[model samples]
Target chain A: MAKKKTSLYREFVKGLWDDNPVLRMLLGLCPALAVTNSAINGLAMGMATTFVLLSSSIIISLLRKVIPHQVRIAGYIVIIATFVTVADKFLAAFLPEISKSLGPYVPLIVVNCLILGRQEAFSSKNNVGRSILDALGMGTGFIFVLVVLGGIREILGSATLFNLQILGDWFNPWMIMILPPGAFLTLGILIGLGNWLNERKVKV
Target chain B: MSLLLLFLSAAIVNNFVLTYFLGICPFVGVSKRVSSAVSMGMAVMFVMTITAAVTWLIYHLLLVPFKIEILEYVSFILVIASLVQLVEMFIKKMSKPLYDTLGIYLPLITTNCAILGLALFSVLREYSFIESLVFGIGAGAGFTLALVLMAGIREELELSNVPKPFKGAGITMIVAGSLALAFMGFAGLI
Candidate 1:
């Protein structure tokens, strides 16, 4: 019994850094790279994604037995899309600006492989509590990376962090840091850095 | 003319993968080789085109008429998920060779945000049926264009000695950044 509990803890913690879906596993790089120009965008996107992931994980875990093997993927997507719709509407009606800024991305989360990946790989096989924990870990892992990228881009691009200017007047903004290419560049380097770290760990 | 502008805009002026950063998953994951990138690009284009046509019809015709636009995200994703599965099965039976070429990428398309984004964008922009189809195809072409170019460059890059900090993804990103800048030149087109 103790061993099972400890193993559950290990699964939860693994997603934080070691098997991070964003930086390490590289499963859900689409949103991690985009929609993170500012800290606020990153936080909002992260939270919204977390909410969807949590709900979908719970539901998929609960339905694991009944879902037909042939149609499990579709079943997972339908569950995810339902929650994503809820999250999207909740944001649009409540937080219009963030909704507008996120644009189609909020809806695009429906197809985000991370959520589906977890369902097919982890959630479908685990119990509800373990699935929720794994989802939380993965979601937080994703948010950590987003906030870092958003901080870098926002600080460098606008001389601001979290919407507050931090640089002096003489400082010139690296205008491209927050642009589309900047996103790719930031994520690519981050991925490289992640690889470097993982390689060092392996060497050790 | 307006439709043409949409095509030009989505394809080059504002590429989904390059400019909007919608589909970076496939962009980086599959762009290692030119042949795979081209095949993946073709698959995306094919599915995206079908998704746009179907989603547009469902959204404007069925959902809008019924005043249940709230179902947009749910319904669109569900349709896309099943459609991708159906395509995978059909291809396996009808064209085993093409299925082998596409490999795992066929089902992976369901998770490509660019596909969903195309559908959502079509609805968001209030595009008509034909307009949505054009937008879908254009987005796919743009994704293919960007992926193929990156693959071609990376193929050559394997032989080149890049700087340390920018060795792998860093330099790839910097190159993409510059490429994005170059693509910005197409702003004047259409």
Candidate 2:
């Protein structure tokens, strides 16, 4: 029983770092780059994605047996789209500012390879309990990366964090840190740092 | 002249890949080789043009009229999937050479967010049908341009590298950042 529990724990923990959807696996880079201009935007995008991922994983895992292998991809996409619509509507209704800033990206979640990749990879094969754990782990990792990235960009770009001034009067914002290029540059360096850390761990 | 401006703006001044970050998957995945990148770009351009036209029709004619705009995400995704499938079949049946050239890339286009993003942007902007079509072609062209440029750089990048950890995807991304910065120079064009 202990062994089984530990393995389940490992399943959940791996997604947090080792199999991180953004920094490590490099899945779902579009939104990771698009919406991370502000820390709040990143957090919002992450939460919305997690909602879709968790719901779809549950549904897909529950119906794994019923969904035919030949039509599984289509079925999975439909299920994902349904939940994405819910998340989109929820955001638009309650958080209109974030929704408008996120723009079509809320709807683009339907095609986020991370969510669909999870459905195909972990959820479809695993049981419901494990699928939920996996989704939570991946979602957390995604959110962590987004928050860090957004925080960095927000601070450097605007000298603020979450719209609050982090750097004082003497500090001039980098300006480029919040632009499209900054996103690519920052994410690139972050990925390299992740790889370096992994390499060091393996060696040690 | 306005339509021409839209085309130019979409193609360069407001490139989908660099500016909006729509198609980063293929921008990163298939950009290792210029040849395959060209083919993928062509396939995407073809499908995107068709998708723009079809999705516009479905939105304005079917969904809006029926008050089913809430089904936008679900319906748009389903339409894209089927359109990709149909286009794949039609190509395979009609032209052997063309099909062989674009054989592997067609299916991948279905999940490409750029196509879906184009549809949503057109709808959001309330662009007319012809404008949507022009925007689609232009976006596809911009995507192709970026992919090819990245591939060319990667080809050269293979020969010279400084750090072990920053190789491959890391370097590609930094290069993309530089490219984006350069592309920003075109901001004044429009």
The candidate that achieves the highest lDDT relative to the unseen native structure = 2
**Per-residue lDDT of candidate 1, residues A81-189 (tens digit):** 8998899999999999999998888888887878888898899998999999999999999889889999999988899998998999999999888888788778778
Give candidate 2 misplaced runs (Cα > 4 Å): B90-106
* Worst lDDT 10-window in candidate 2 chain B: B99-108
Docking class of 1: medium
TM-score of 1: 0.94
lDDT for A11 (candidate 2):
80
Report the C-alpha lDDT of model 2 over B1-190, residue by residue, as the tens digit. 9999999999999999999999898889889889878878887898899999999999999999999999988888888898888888887888787677655556767779999999999999999999999999999999999999999999999899559999877888899999999999999998
Please provide, for model 1 over B39-154, each residue's C-alpha lDDT reduced to its tens digit, 9 standing for 90 to 100. 88987888899999999989878998899998888788888888888888887898787788777667888888899989888887888889999999999999999999999999
Q: What local distance difference test score does each model get?
A: 0.85, 0.91
* Chain B TM-score, one value per candidate, order as shown: 0.90, 0.92
- Measured on C-alpha atoms, candidate 2 has an lDDT of 0.91
lDDT of 1 at A184: 73
* Candidate no. 2 TM-score: 0.96
lDDT of 1: 0.85
